[model samples]
Target: MEKSGLAEFKVEIVESCLVQPCLPDSPRSTLYLSNLDNQPLVRMAFNTLLVYEACENVLPHPAKTIREALSKVLVYYYPLAGRLRKKEDGKLQVECTGEGVLFVEAMVDNSLSVLGDLDQLKPSFKQLLFRFPFDNALEDVHPMVLQVNHFTCGGFVVAVSFNHCVCDGRGVSHFLKSLGEMVRGHVKPSLEPIWDRELLKPRNILVHDLVSNEEKIECKPHSWTPPVYKESIQMSLILDFETLKYVKDGIMPKCFDICTTFEIVAALIWQARTKVLEIPHTESVSISFAVDVRRSFSPPLPNGYNGNCIVAACAKAIVQDVITQPLSYLVNIIKKTKMSLTNKYIRSIIDTDQFPLDVHSNQANIILTDWRWLGFSDVDFGSGSPVNICPMHWNENGINASNGFIFLHSPERKDNGIKVIMWMPSQEFNLFEIEIESIIRKYVIKGSKF
Candidate 1:
């Protein structure tokens, strides 16, 4: 029996198998991955869980329907059904062997209500997804894995884990959308999948040589080291649109002409986290976020072209300025950093292979990625859209903590607010929360600026 924080329950796996492409003549050729896709930073598998409430009179079993839909969808996104292989040059490519991805049908003993708060990532949530206990390299296992766990209340959870090296958040959402389309009885996917990885190859003339090199950070080869934390936790913080607007209004007069909600909220959290960590005043701190470059290119990547199209955009400043400066000061730094992500700059990143090396080495760095715009909630699997979608948060060996921030939409969808989920050391989390509340009370509640 697995114990969720809210209750004790058991998840029994009923069936597990490889789901292959439905088409008999699916292509069996090798596909090259782009430089962005081959980066070491995104080598691991990422997991997410989608929750759907019980339907009144739906007849077909959810797992059967989803499995069939997945098989059909794999015909279009065939690379997902393939395995990742490494070349002599140390880059990754997909071997289209039609081996297919893993699919599991599971049954949970408890109802949706007994699962407790779906918003919080709990230990029992691990049971919702199939777990591999044995040590196996990524190339030795399936690239895409899905498990459909049916609750006693007739609801189900679609927990999926896919290789991040193949595609990014947007790309996965696009693939999921296609699977949903198949479940809804669509003969063909609304949008076709495109594979133009070669188009993003380094050009003849290097971009850095042609442009100013001041912004170019030294390129460093990424090395993945398993993390170990003494004590860690994940917490969620909600900030309503009203509160954000109030803070922005107070700071806009002191900062740039336009301030986005993301900029304002991110700046506040960065300031709070930096202050709580008590970083050295002389140390250099950075805030890194992903910026999509699909539309930034000259010809503009096609609509269906889903690959890793995001680049890390970073804002850097001394620790003293990050903590002591006004909130608007950090906001301006963030805004300016984002505005600097011009088309040429994005090209330079690919051509020079230079990414934000600071994010990996700097102890004071705070990394954030926004899921509010990722379109995960928009995927419908015949029982209507999922009520909630969240990451499957757990540490390897129960001691490793993923340190980062994610901006998610309000689960209830009743308000214009967003949820910021953060993972850090447990002791630091308390102090960080205090700093956040202090900022909110000072600025939004009392109409005072920091």
Candidate 2:
């Protein structure tokens, strides 16, 4: 076999395989209890398997070529092929004791569907990789769930659901890109993965030690104890770049030039939510923004580095203060928080070795994580590219609340704008919608002068 450029790789469908499960001993079995702080974090691993009708031109033997590529990619993630375990002392650990890949067949035809709606075919894929069924001890050995479906036109989609604890968004993307490169015949990966956990080991910082008494204070849940609230949430209303720009323009002029789309929009929504919820002015609210820390490493993490490489930067203030403060002030605070992503801070968190295991109840909170910057648009599963991609469901890390928000680029539009999909309580959603409408209307007549 001659070395070829990435274009020489082929595509084919292979039956997904499931590995055999291993029962943990009494001491090792206890690790499962610690993950119960929220829900168990499991990684769903799958690929959109598309068979190319044009494979004759692309390769000599499509099936053989694709199998070779898959083998190569699998070897890279070999270190991660294991199940999570807990020590008797409650420390969580991952043991690489699993083998073989789990797979299933798709019920639908290869033609007549689009690649972007790959998730739609999950129901018929039949063989699930992992399900959290308690006490049965003989748990399935598959670490990731596989969804195989055919597109309406002719192709297949392989989507994997990975536990966030196993890898973060960046890590997953790196794995996928490497797979794609292997398929395309790029034998040597551009960014080799690093597995030395010691590189991220935390130093001794009394205030930041995760297991220390003082560090536990920071992780302790807040005690607001407000009336219980609940609401059904769904993904709706996809906005284009122009609409988002229009909304941003409306709020920018009210603040100094330093304000960002996130802070401005967050402020408006926070104010509207307070009024609609009829929460007292004295009550405090906080916005939790997920910040990527890839660049915070001393020498900077490699592009292929995976795992949770992010931290949350939270901004808290009374509802009245948020509504009354200049947008500039809020923006400045956010900027300062972002600047805190120094190596010291990251080392502190990683060293504390404590995952944020508890949810703060006292703070009225909302989560904002931007997928726009994640290069989702570049994910090409052999059918042009995904028209749009959004997480239909997100569970794990105590972010299953109704107030979470995930923003992605609008796949329908080619412009440099963003689409925000927010999951807020019913009252908060209504208030946010009304304010957004008003802001859009206001910006149409008068643009930002800032």
Candidate 3:
């Protein structure tokens, strides 16, 4: 199973689907960014591209085929563009180029040993991916950055960088599924893409009237920041469903029958992280989650409508208080925060005139994103689907914090439990490991074979 062999297969798939007949040009469209505040909107416009490979029979071929497949995929996304505008009332509106979209690639390297231990791979991949340099290449024709020389031992890595405004995780998954279909010989996508940007139009020209018009926006004049930490961060342990459920159930007694896996785990992590970081009680920390708004669209976005359909929900608390609080309290905080996510909130965040540019940057230390319910395992790329599909990094907008976590459902595992993937600074991670193991040991009960 050499990289070249896999490369050949990749080429065959791309040629049969893309190169032979040439892809049809996507319709011209534009996204209106003027509605969105500068910093968060720009952050939303950038996306991450991921490459997954089996340790056995790594792709073998001239990097050309892989690169070609990438180019072809971009062709499919090209028609999508974004627009930034301010209305007469100074309301910011984000309009998508419904005609098409754009994407960027993020790359990383892994080892056979890392794959052998899923837990280690999870965090290691995240840390490596956050260091990806796509933003530095924003001015390039492709607006894509390559993360080469990642995942070096007993395997190879694939890099992808995409524009954030074009799509969210679900939308990106749709595109990947389409790419897999093309690779597997589906000339016509089973799921036809739906591109009606008009549907996303805001009802009022001035959506969020509360945001002050005088707030100033700020952003890094340039993309590309040095890695947050110099030391290499390795993946930790994988918490199986049985263990996770045990912990969740144990905490449920305190939560009064209301709490999601995300809230509980988030509380646990936040507590541990604050302790490890040794932050003062007065320090404010928050947990930001991404909320998909496709369902909120007037008619609900069509099944294959690919573009950004997400918003952020932040739950803030004092550093010391969050750590000492009961799981139930944290659950309530999360629920209340989620309830506040509305079209108005989305518009408010997008309305640069209302919200200050610094709002997005002043978020909490811990960020959580849940893909457990996203049904990623159903994404079959023709080769028996993925046993696992985890995000390689957390660099997307609000989630790219030094301490970030993503929740994923293991492919077809009967345990019905979710896997928690976390990344943090090496020192913080070590402290986290100690706290997590202690919590599990104290609160979790082992289950039958799962």
Tens digits of per-residue lDDT, candidate 3, 163-258, equal 554455676566656655655556555676654544554455655355332212232232322245643332434466667677666667666456
- What lDDT does the true structure give each of the candidates? 0.78, 0.49, 0.50
In the range 1-450, model 1's lDDT, one tens digit per residue, is 012247767899999999999998989999988878876567667788888888863426999998999999999988888999989888889999998889999999998876654545556667888766437765787878999999888898899988888888888888898998998899978987887788788787846443432233333332323234575656677788888887887888889768998999889888998887676676666788887778889989899887888777778777678888888998988888887777787777678766644455554577888988877888888777788777765655653244588888876673678888777666777778899888767677664545
| Candidate 1 deviant stretches above 4 angstroms | 1-5, 57-59, 133-135, 210-229, 356-358, 400-402, 446-450
RMSD of each: 4.0, 9.0, 8.6
**Positional deviation of residue 392's Cα in model 2 after best superposition, in angstroms:** 3.5
User: How do the predictions measure up, each by TM-score?
Assistant: 0.91, 0.71, 0.67
Cα lDDT over the full model 3: 0.50
Give candidate 3 regions above 4 Å deviation: 1-158, 205-229, 232-234, 297-299, 347-364, 373-376, 387-401, 410-417, 445-450
Candidate 1 vs candidate 2: the lDDT winner is: 1
Error of 1 at 159 (Å): 0.5
Judged by lDDT, which candidate is best?
1
Model 2: runs farther than 4 Å from truth? 1-16, 19-68, 109-141, 204-231, 243-257, 272-274, 324-329, 354-363, 394-400, 414-416, 424-431, 447-450
Residue 141 lDDT in candidate 3: 24
TM-score order of candidates, top first: 1, 2, 3
